[model samples]
Target: MGLLWGLIIGGLAGWIAGNLTRGGGFGLLGNIIVGLVGGFLGGVLFRLLGLAATGMIGSLVMSVIGAVLLIFIVGKIKGRR
Candidate 1:
């Protein structure tokens, strides 16, 4: 159940982040991967900032933010190469 929700949320988060930042989607699996990683990254960043997510929506928000940041960073890195 938890894993299922995580995947669903992750997919949604990634899709949202991708659309928001790049104006496109990463497909289903790619979105899930990005979103899971983004959620972890977001949690770490929130902790560092003394912030916390309280519920599913909060988690989604955090994931989206992290995904966007992740995408941006990756884009920059790729651009530099």
Candidate 2:
């Protein structure tokens, strides 16, 4: 199912983003939230560029990009504290 794939890819992307940005992850809830947002952001970006993602690899790549962006934003916000 699409939902299943989304959860898996999003979790991976979020984990990767957190690790890369903060040297750690924000736990299960954080990862899920970031991942869900990342998936939506990825889809939006792809659409904005007049492109479409295809297959597992493409989706994963997009998710990673979105996750990276999300993590960067979150890191910046957290750093302000």
lDDT value, residue 77 of candidate 1: 98
lDDT of 2 by residue, 1-81 (tens): 988887887787778778877798768778767877987888898899998888978887787778778777777998899
Model 1 stretches astray by more than 4 angstroms: none
The worst-scoring run of ten residues by lDDT in candidate 2 lies at 24-33
Name the TM-score of candidate 1.
0.97
State how far residue 14 of model 2 sits from its true place (Å). 0.7
Residue pairs clashing in model 1 are none
The global C-alpha lDDT for each of the candidates, from Candidate 1 onward, is 0.94, 0.80
lDDT of 1 by residue, 1-81 (tens): 999999999999999999999898899999999999999999999999999998899999999989888998899999998
How much is the lDDT of residue 41 in candidate 1? Answer: 91
Give the lDDT of residue 14 in candidate 1: 96
